[model samples]
Target: MTVLKAADELEEIVARVGPTAARLLTRGEEETMPEIAEALGMTEKAARARPTHYEHLDS
Candidate 1:
């Protein structure tokens, strides 16, 4: 499998998923890495590690 460690790879993902979803929105329980990877043209692991896994830090 290919790794998306490079800036371009990450950028491609961000472009496809939108900045809010890509850089902020977290994946739901039903969502899997493979789904995102395929959409972003990245590897499952890479997509899983994406910053899209967002969480609310404040109450």
Candidate 2:
């Protein structure tokens, strides 16, 4: 499969879950961010910013 850019991955996540929905999925779920971010080929930072995606590794 072709690799995706960070911005593109971010967009995809938001498109799938929406900002609000993504947050609901991630709330209090800090343990899952690293795996999800890696799966999306993004740093923890970019992934967290995708609408309601995980917040951050440093949090």
Top of the candidates by lDDT: 2
TM-score of 2: 0.47
Compared with the true structure, what per-residue lDDT tens digits does model 2 show for residues 1-59?
34568778877675655645666647755887787789989998887776433333223
Residue 27, model 2, lDDT: 73
Tens digit of per-residue lDDT, candidate 1, span 1-59: 25545777876665665645644435362365567678889987777666534222121
Residue 43 of model 2, lDDT score: 95
Q: Estimated TM-score per prediction? A: 0.37, 0.47
Best of the candidates, TM-score: 2
Candidate 2 local Cα displacement, residue 18, angstroms:
1.5
